[model samples]
Target: MDTITHTLFGLGIYKAINKENMSKREKQTLLFTAIGASQIPDIDVISQLWDTSGQYQMWHRGITHSLFLVPVWALLFFILNFFIFRLKSWRFFWIALLAVFIHDTSDVFNAWGTGYLEPFSNARLTFGTIPIIDFVIWFIFLLAFILSKKGSYKESSIYRISWIMIALHIIIQSIQGYALYKQYEPRYEQLALSASFLPWNYSVIGKDENTVDIIQDSLLTQKHLMYKLQSSDNSNLKKLFKQNPKAQTLYKWSPFVVVVDNEERLGIYDPRFYRKGQSFLFEFIEKTQK
Candidate 1:
C-alpha cells in the first residue's frame, strides 16, 4: 500500500483504542507507538541510495517488511517509548506489535507484494485483491471520523466498527478476486492480477508461451481485452543483462515480463503496469547503428 494509506491505518488503530481513562502523556505515547511502527517497515526504501547493483527492486520491500522483523520493530519501539516517555507498560509493546504486523500483512494484498517470509523464503507473495490506494478504506476511516464528531457514539467504538468494515471489504474483494483468478487460470501458463481503483474490477494478465494478454473484467462485466503483447523469448538477453543490470533485476522482480526485441532496441517490461502505448516499468537498450 501507499504511504498515505499506511499512515491512515496507523491513525485508525490508534483511534480504535479506548483511551478515555488514560493520562494525557499516556495517550501521546500510544499515538507515537501506533504511527511509528506502522511506518517503520518502509525504512527499506532508503536502500535505493546505496543500491549499486540495481537490486533496489528486490531490496525495497525486502527483509525489513518480513514477518520475522515485526517483533524486532515492536521491541525497538517499546524500548524507545520507555526511554523517551519514561513508561514501562507492556501495552506499548503489544500495540507496536499489532501496528507492525498489520503493516507487513496488509502489503501482501497489493500487487507490489512483499517478502513476507524473508530469509525463510524470497517469494513476493501478492494477492492483488486490493489496490495500493483503496478509496474504500479511506471512506471507512472518513465515515468513522465524521460519526465520532457528529454522532453520540464513542470515538473508540466508531473507529472499531470502521476497522471491522475495512476487514469485511478486504475479505469480500479477495474472494471475488480469487474466483476471477481461478476462472481464467486454465487458459494460461502463468497469471497475475491487479485490482482497479473501483471495487470488484480487476486487470488480469495471462501468459501462454510468448504471448501475453491483458484483460479487464469483473464478476459483473464480461472480460474486455485491453492489450495483447508478444514476448521475444527467443532473444538472448545476456548482453542486455550485462549492459543494464537494472533490466535483469526487473526481469527477476516481476512475476512475468513482456520481452521486446525489435529493430530499435532490446527491452523487457512488466505487462501488469502497461498503460498508453508503453509501460512505466520498461527498461531497454538501444541498438548501436551499423
Candidate 2:
C-alpha cells in the first residue's frame, strides 16, 4: 500500500484503542507508537543512496519489511518512547508490534509485494488483489472518521467497525481476483494479476511462450484484450545484462518479462505494468554500431 493508506491505518488503529481513562501523555505516546511503527519499515528507501549495483529494486521493500524485523522495530519504538516520554509501559511495545505487523502484512496484497520472509526466503509475496492505493479503504476510514464526529457513539467503536468493513472489502476483492487468476491459469505458462483502482476490476497479464497478453477484466463484464506483446525469448540477453546491470536485476526480480530484441535496442519489461505503448519498469540498452 501507499504512504497515505498506511498512515490512515495507523490512525484507525489508534482510534480503535479505548483511551477513556488514559492520561493525556499516554494518549500522545500511543499515537506516536501507532503512526511511527506503521512507517518504520519503509526506512529501507534510504538504501538508494548506496545502491551502486542497481539492486534498489530488491532492497526497497527487502529485509526491513520482513516479519522477523517487526519485533525489532517494536522494541526500538518502545525504547524511544521510554527515553522521550519517560513511559515504561509494555502497552507501547505491544501497540508498536501490531502497527508494524499491519504495515508489513498489508503490503503483500499489492502487486509490488515485499520480502515478507526475508533471510528465510527472498520471494516477493504479492497477491495483487488490492491496488497500491485503494479508494474503498480510504472511503471506509473517511466514513468512520465522519461518523465518529457526528454520532453519540464512542469513537473507538466507530473505528473498530471500520476495520471490520475494511477487512470484508479485502476478502471480497481477493476472492474475486483469485477466481480470475484460476480462470486464466490453464491458458498461460505464467500469470500476474493487478487490481484496478475501480473495485472488482483487474488487469491480468499472462505469458505463453514468447507472447504476452494483458487483459482488462471484471467479474461482471466481458474480458477485454488490452495489449498483445511479443517477447524475444530466444534472444541472448547476456550483452544486455552486461551493459545494464539494472536489466539483470529487473529480469530476476519480475516473475516474467517481455523481452525486446530489435535493431534499435535490446530490452526487457514487466508486462504487468505496461501502459501507453511502454512500461515504466523497462530496462534497455541501445544497439551499438560495429
Candidate 3:
C-alpha cells in the first residue's frame, strides 16, 4: 500500500475513536501513532539478523502481533508520554491501543507476505484474493473525508460506520482466501505442474484435480505462466469454462514468462515492467516450500 493510503487509514482510525474529545496535539499524535504502530507486525521481517546466534526461535507472529500486544505497547506509550508530556497515563491507553491495533489489523489485508501472526508463527498468511489497493475501500474513505477542514469533519457517525464496514470486509477477505484454497487445494497435486511445490503460495488460485492457474496481466509481465492439468479432478475446470475461458491467459499470452525454460536467467514478476538484465530480481519459488 502507498504511504498516502497508510496516512488515510491512520486518519480514519483517529476519527473513529476520538469522535469529539481530543486536543489538536492528541489528534496529530494519533495519526502518527496509527501509521507507525500498524507497521509493527512487520518487525518479524527483520528479526533474523538480530537473532545473533541464529538459535533464536518462536512462532513468528505468536504474541507480539496478537490482541495481547495492544495494551503492552499502550502501557509503554502511556508511561513514555507521561514523562514526555506530563499527561495522564490512563488517558493515553486508548490512544496507544487504537494506534497499534489498527496498524496490525489494516496490514492483515496483504497476503501474509506480511506477518499477522508475529511472535506466534513465522508463516506469512495471505488471502491473495484481492489486489493490495482495493478501489472500493479507497473511494469510500476518500469521499467521506475532505482534504481541508469543513467544519467538524473531525467526527461523524457516517465515518464511524463506514470504517466498521470496511473492517468487516477485510475480515471476510481472509476467509474467502482460505476457502478458495480449501475448495481447490486437494486437487492441486494432480492438476498442477509436477514441479508444483507451493504454486498457491505466490498467488491464491485454488487448484482442481485437473488445473491450477493464477491470473495476472500478461501484457505487463511477459513470459512464463504457471498452469496445472489435473490428475483426475475436473469439477473446477467445468466451472472455469462456465465462468471465464480466458483463465491463465496471462502466461499463455507470453512465452517469455517461461522462467524455467531458461534456467540460467529467471523471468521475474516485473512490476512497472522492468526489462531483464537491468537488475536482479528473486522469488521464493514454490519448489522451496517445505
Candidate 4:
C-alpha cells in the first residue's frame, strides 16, 4: 500500500478509539503512537543512501517490515510515550502494536510485497490482490468520516464499520485475483499477478520457457493479451550480472523476471510492472561493451 493510505489507516485507528475520558496529553500520545507506528517500517528507504551494491530492491521492504520487528517497534513507541507524555496506560502499547501489525500485514496483499519473515526467509510474499493505491479503500474511509460527522452513530462505530468493509473488499479482490491466476497456472511454468487500479481487474504475467505473456484479466471479461515477449538466452549472464548487479538483486527479489538478450544488449525485468512498451524495472548492459 502507499504512504497516504497507511497514514489514513493510522488516522482512522486513532479516530475509532473511544476517548470520552482521555486527557489532552493522553490523546496526543495515542495519536503519535498510531501514526508513527504506521510509518516506521518504511524508514528502511534510507538504506538507499548506503546501497552501492544495488541491493536497495531487497533492502527497502526488508528487515524493518518483518513480523519479528513489529513487537520491537511497538515497545519503542511505548517507551517513547512513557517519557514524552508520562503515559501509563497499557492500552496505548496494544494500540501501537496493532498499528505496526497492520502496517506489515497489509503490505503482503500488494504486488511489491515485503520481507515479512525477513531473517528466517528471503521470500517476497505477495498476494497481488490489491493495487498499491486503491480508490475503493479511499471511498470507504471517506464515507466513514462523513458518517461520523453527520450521522447519529458514534465516530468509533462508524470507523469500525469501515474497517469491516475494507477487510471484505480485500477478500473479494483476493478471490478474484486467485481465480484469474489459476487460469494461467496450468499453462505457464511461472506466473505473477498485479492488480489493476480498477476493481476486479488484474494484469497476469505468465512465463513458459522463452516466451512471456502479459494479459489483462477479469471475471467479467475475456483475458486480453496486452504484451508478449520472447526471452533471450542467459548464456552470458556473467557479463550481464557484472554490469548490472541491480538486475541480479531484482532476479533474487522478484517471483520471476523476463530475460532480454538481443543484438544490442542483455538484461532482465519483472514483467508485472511492464507498461507502454517498457518496464519500470528493466536493467541492461550494452553488447558493445563486450
Query: Predictions ranked by lDDT, top down?
Result: 2, 1, 4, 3
Tens digit of per-residue lDDT, candidate 4, span 202-256: 9998889888999998999988999999887455677788888998999898888
- Tens-place lDDT digits, model 2, residues 1-290: 99999999999999999999999999999999999999999999999999898899999888999999999999999999999999999999999999999999999988898999998998888999999999999999999999999978999999999999999999999999999999999999999999999999999999999899999998899999999999999999999888888999889889899999999999999888889999999999999832
What clash count goes with each model?
A: 0, 0, 29, 0
Query: Relative to the unseen true structure, what is the Cα RMSD of model 2?
Result: 1.1
Better of 3 and 4 by lDDT: 4
167 Cα displacement, candidate 4 (Å): 0.4
Per-model lDDT: 0.93, 0.94, 0.46, 0.91
The residue pairs in collision within model 1 are none
Q: Which candidate number has the best lDDT?
A: 2
Candidate 3 lDDT over residue span 1-290, tens digit each = 43455566766766666436667766655555555555554455466666543222232443556655777777777776656555664655776677677655654445322345554654544335444456656776876666324655445555787688776766665455455456556744411111111222223333343343542212223325433322222112333222332322222221112122132322222111212322122221232222
lDDT of 1 by residue, 1-290 (tens): 89999999999999999998999999999999999999999999889889888898899888999999999999999899999999999999999999999999999998989999998998898999999999999999999999999869999999999999999999999999999999999999999999999999999999999999999999999999999999999999988898888999999889999999998999899988898879999888888722
Query: Candidate 4, clashing residue pairs?
Result: none
Worst 10 residues of 1 by lDDT: 281-290
